[model samples]
Target: MKFSTYFNDWLYGQDGYYTKYRTIGKGGDFYTAVSTSKFFGGSIGNKAISTIQSGFLPSDTTIVEVGAHHGYLLADMIEFIYTLQPQLLDTLTFAIVERFPHLQEQQKKYFKESFGDAVKLIHYNNISEIKLDSAFIVANEIFDAFEAELVYTTQEGIRKNVVVTNHQLGFEPCDDLFLNAICDKYGIRQGEIALGYETFAQNLAQNIKKFEFITFDYGEKYPRNDFSTRIYYKHKVFPLFQEELNLNELFGKSDITYDVNFMHLIDSFNQAKIKNVSYQTQLKALVEFGIITLLEILKEKAGESAYLREVQKVKTLLEPTGMGDRFKVAIFRKESHA
Candidate 1:
């Protein structure tokens, strides 16, 4: 069976696809930036504070977080907000949007134990239903999850819907309208394969209004050959993996993600008429706003080693060749509704 077909069957059926993913943790398939260190949350929290202060009335602001895995960052933001501006804490409401049921339950458990009823948890299967008048939206590593159409260009013309159907999965060309539209928009010529992160990013930008968007992900601009139709399973990167296979079985129940093009995101933001967009690494943004200063304050509450580790993690986020450079942070702001 084709990899995509197998994946659809396993994920849709009562098989162990979702069950296996529910158990992903510290020793699971891979560790996210959040799991790697607390500094990631601390640095992001610092950015969130600056964002909130710049546009909204803290007393009536709603901070919405998409793909809020484990709720650690949300907790960190709450603490940071309290420390910086105590008055905003009482009026603040946090809405965590999580898709996975098991993870949502875990988040609830953590929030209930630590924050009581202060935080509001919302389960969303799609982004279309999220309604907001004036809010600050944050999505970390969320765009990469959008299912993308794959196209391969040849001397003859652009081929669409490339699928693998051999003993081992590979690419076979098909005629898909959506894929063709992407090719037309991007001017991807014959003899080149292109993925559809630009289309997905543009759609997301058009959907939401009346808020500042801060997205963290990894990708590059156009004319970049680094992004291929590939899959990462169990920390192993594979170029020929298709969507029809049992992802959990073939990849050891890991999370499959794609690289996001930051330039495409900037273009989308401009198309949406969301003026005032800033792009930087997570570490640079944190340091500019004094994340080290926050660490010093945390050292008094926690131990020195814990504080230092957090600072180091933030520093790692700044390394140009490391996550700091690989991962790009884009911030978009609209005029405040209030």
Candidate 2:
């Protein structure tokens, strides 16, 4: 089977990791910015308000989150937005784009418990289902979750893709025109390339007449020469290609992920008529979104002990050698083509 097929099943199949067993935070396979601090979501809430006030988005625009795990990020954003601008809640609608029924139930339960009857949440099974005139879309660590294809160039300049055969992963030449063209266009000889970004972008372009899109994920703008795919099992990192590693034993049990190639990602959206507004490190983006100001407000309202505890957690989101520098924030905008 092709690696993308194998990968998609392992992470998203009916009984896949995300479908039944995926967990996030310190106890799970990994920690996301959402798990680090509510301030992460709070910062984004600030940006949302600014966008609406600056006339970039309408007041009634839906705040949509794609691949919202447990709906924590969106919930936190709503909480912070309520704290900052409760009046805006009267106009804005909230929604989550989640594919799996089980995950959707989980998100619904979380939202209900978090806000009770105060907020009305909409659910969609796919991006293509969103039929909004305008939207403010946010996706955190979502691109890395998309199925990816690994490809490399041969000595004769032939392109080959990685696949799973006989329970072992190996590389072979294939007839994937899209991957071939993308590799050639970007001068990418070898790396794990995310699939479906163009389709995802195009779906948003077609479904939502006007939109502002923001996503946070770990990656570089340029393609990496070396493979970045790895496995996370109980917070322990395992190199995907390590010899003696049993691929079958880890199937559907471990989280498999790779760094994104943002250049390819931005270009994909660009081709779909969604233009990128900015791409920057998580540190810069969070600071600009007023994470520090939110922290100060918490310190004053929540007391010193609570403030100290939260600050330490927030540091992980802004740590120089860690999430701060490793993760990136990409923002894109699309106005009515008509």
Residue lDDT tens for model 2, 80-162: 99999999999999999998888899988988899899999999999988999999999998899899999988889888899
Q: Pick the candidate with the highest lDDT.
A: 2
- TM-scores for every predicted model: 0.79, 0.97
Give the RMSD in angstroms, all C-alphas superposed, for model 1: 4.3
Runs in model 1 deviating more than 4 A are 1-26, 122-125, 155-160, 164-174, 187-209, 226-230, 241-248, 299-304, 336-338
Model 2 bad stretches (over 4 Å): none
Candidate 2 displacement at residue 18 in angstroms: 1.2
